[model samples]
Target: MSKLAWLNGLPLEEAKAEFLRCCGSTRWAEAMARARPFKTDTAVYSEAGWLWSQTSTEDWREAMAHHPRIGDVSKLRERFKASGAWSEQEQKGVQGAGEDVLQGLADGNREYEERFGFIFLICATGKSAQEILEQLRERIKNPPALELRIAAGEQAQITRIRLEKLLTSP
Candidate 1:
């Protein structure tokens, strides 16, 4: 059966678990499960976007907690074991990076978190390590208010991609 059909048919508790795996927000997952029986893949994505927009700063932070630090290969393998496959796929760009670039990313991640009180977030799906590093360098200059919004936007993009993945998976 198709994934969309599978999602449409799952029980509420099971569906909430699946959505949590995709987005990592209990509220978002519960809201999605309550909005069930989605008629199409687009409908699922639409609802995801809407629900995310309705979420709070704390909710965004909760979702962000689900991701491992970028360039942190050990955490990607161990800390994020629940989302390890997806995280690895999303960060394919970092896999073959040079050590200097990796170290730069690690250092930048530290500085970003220290400055903003949260991890640096980027979509990172198709970006190269150098490209991601450049983005990090630039975004780190932004003030906290602006950077939090930027991070939330990136998380929204990630949620949309994961939602698409969920519906397309077998």
Candidate 2:
């Protein structure tokens, strides 16, 4: 019994709940649940990509609301408990940084949110805290529209990672 097999076999409500854990947008989760019985892993990933593209800015913002600010480890662990250990794992690179680096990330996150009206989202899986901060500093220079698109793209990458985890988890 593979994870995808388990996912494909889940009841509709349960499937929706699981998908919600992957991406916080209700629309994405609902669309994923309705697109069930995916025969292949690629099909699942394809459906997720298509649905995310079709989603509106409102839906993207909804998903963004689910994440903590970058470097906010306490909030990541305590507030995002619904996502369990995944958030903490994804942000592992920032776990034990010097206060100066953490403070830089924190300040950059604030400036980014003030500019773009959402959290600074990045695929932080393997990025170091300094590298993440550098990316944020550079990205903050983009115009609002461009930055929003970049954030959404980063969220899409995160969605893909979570989906892969779902399929691979025992």
**lDDT for every model?**
0.89, 0.91
Tell me the lDDT of candidate 2: 0.91
Task: List the candidate 1 regions with Cα displacement exceeding 4 Å.
Answer: none
Q: What TM-score does structure 2 among the candidates reach?
A: 0.96
In the range 1-170, model 2's lDDT, one tens digit per residue, is: 87888999999999999998889999999999999999999999999999999999899999999988888888876888777478888889998998999999988998888888999999899999999999999999999888888889999999999999889976
Clashes of each: 0, 0
Local accuracy of candidate 1 as per-residue lDDT tens digits, 6-40:
98899999999889877878899899999988988
Give the top-scoring candidate (lDDT): 2
lDDT score, candidate 1: 0.89
Q: Model 2 segments beyond 4 Å from truth? A: none
Candidate 1 similarity to native, TM-score: 0.95
lDDT of 1 at 164: 83
